[model samples]
Target: MTVELMATAEHAPHREEFAALYAQVQQFYAQQMRILDADADGGEARWAATFTEDAVVELPLLPAPLRARAGLTHYARAAAERRRRAGSRLHHWVGMLDVRPRPDGTLHTRCSALAHATPPGATSKILYVCVMEDVLVRAHGTWRTAHRRITRDDLA
Candidate 1:
């Protein structure tokens, strides 16, 4: 019994650290969705701010991965244009986050993302369901996404 108690005590701090890391990673994705789904114009800039200066975003529909702030800006502009054309209200639902700390001190996160859209005078519909894999790092004492790869769930 004493040996078991010692082992449990040794693992307690590690468990707390893991919990804290998981919460920070979850918060980062939640903030990303909030900024991306904002109703106000120019929210793309806000969304981009959540990323690192040299962040990379991989979209399933894009030909190549978007890199850095300039690439993010371009993607944001394109997304805005598409939304404007569609005239739909957009929302993102993130679920089931799995976060693990890497040996390099960064965190790897995988989560399900469900995008919904509501057209004028119409009910909301699921636009797409995707799984997002991300590498997050701590910069300036805050967690920011360094890399994000989105894979659409074809079976869904």
Candidate 2:
């Protein structure tokens, strides 16, 4: 009976499961960025679809103490709109490097990204470069960002 229980220590299968879950979550993020990039008129609608029904967004104006992911989808949509209206094109995305699971089943993720925007008659500018720190969760088998911290590197 002891010999039969020896296989319990194997973590290979557990590792595979986590990888699959991570990939699924990443796919959702990729789609959200794509929608924001390709969409001209309906970008907000498409981007909002990727978020949880009760998602929050924080702008630079918010007091640090007041910043919270307590349902700021409307504000995020408006911010996206402001960028869209000002530019001919904007592309922003990240390459994930690490993901760790929290005790509550959320994932803490780290990723590097390069963001660029080009106005109609002006040269494209690489406005921001940095790593994104995210708290992610899978709801209904889909990954949603519960929190995001943008650490921009002005020198990058």
Candidate 3:
């Protein structure tokens, strides 16, 4: 079962309703980023669970789009290893979110995403600045990403 999101807060017919939905979406991103930043056992799986089973992830750095949870999990695991080898940890910070309710009941969202890498005995530095767009669907009482596209500033 999916809940249809209301319009954006600025022009919403019901301000309270939109505000609640906005808070839920914000919390979703917070939890998702927390899982992505963690380097504990089952962290990959936890991060993968933030997306839908058939989610698609597209990145300019990748040769091909990663399809489904399995592909996403593999990518997360590999990325974790690369971070480990570099002796750095990555933190994904997202802001300036613009979310609109789609006619088909999904939400179209875009945000500024910044990634910082912190190495042992070194201060964190910005590694990537990107624009992330997502097609979000509400299912099982929570929002899950159905599709994600990342456009890095350096690559753009």
Candidate 4:
């Protein structure tokens, strides 16, 4: 007889289930980083779609957390415009992800993220090194960020 195991935050995931979850989480981050890097292409709307409508984002540089999709979109637009004006490009790299399943069915994740900036005729320079903690919810068979907190190395 075969038995199936269910995974939860309090208990370990079955091998097959854990592998699938890991892949999904990695793919989500890959897509998110790509959208963020495409700042010049007006990708903010597409990027914002990856988050829940009522998602909250906290950044070390901002005094207040960005609440909802509207706030997130505004921030993305402003950052894109700033990069455009400065003739620079920004790239985001995320690694060392720790993903765990929450009891409520949300995925809790923490990752190290690095922001690199490249100016016209200049080499890329590290702008910020941050730790990103996120709560991801499965919606419509895909993952969406419900909440995120970014703490910069300099500030932390």
**How many pairs of residues in model 1 come into backbone collision?**
0
Candidate 4 on 1-120: residue-level lDDT in tens? 013223332265566677678789999999999998895566998898899999999999788999998889889988998989999999999988778787799989999999999999
- Return the lDDT, model 3, position 52: 99
- Kindly report which residue stretches of model 1 are placed more than 4 angstroms away from their true locations once superposed: 1-13
The global C-alpha lDDT for each of the candidates, from Candidate 1 onward, is 0.81, 0.63, 0.88, 0.87
Candidates ranked, most accurate by TM-score first = 3, 4, 1, 2
Please identify which of the two predictions, 3 or 4, would achieve the higher TM-score against the true structure: 3
lDDT of 1: 0.81
Model 3 TM-score, 2 decimals: 0.92
Clashing pairs in 2: 56-72
- Residue 46's lDDT within candidate 4 is 85
C-alpha-based local distance difference test score of model 3: 0.88
Per-prediction TM-score: 0.86, 0.70, 0.92, 0.91
On lDDT, who's better, 2 or 4? 4
lDDT of 2 by residue, 1-156 (tens): 133222321322485666665576577668877876774665666666665665554333455421333234345566677876775678887774466666787877777877788888988888788777777777787787666666667743
Per-residue lDDT of 1-156 in model 1, one digit per residue for the tens? 245334433544576766666667677778888888876788888888888999999998889899997789778877877888989888999987777666687877788899999998999999899998999888899888899999998743
Stronger candidate by lDDT (1 vs 3): 3
lDDT value, residue 100 of candidate 4: 79
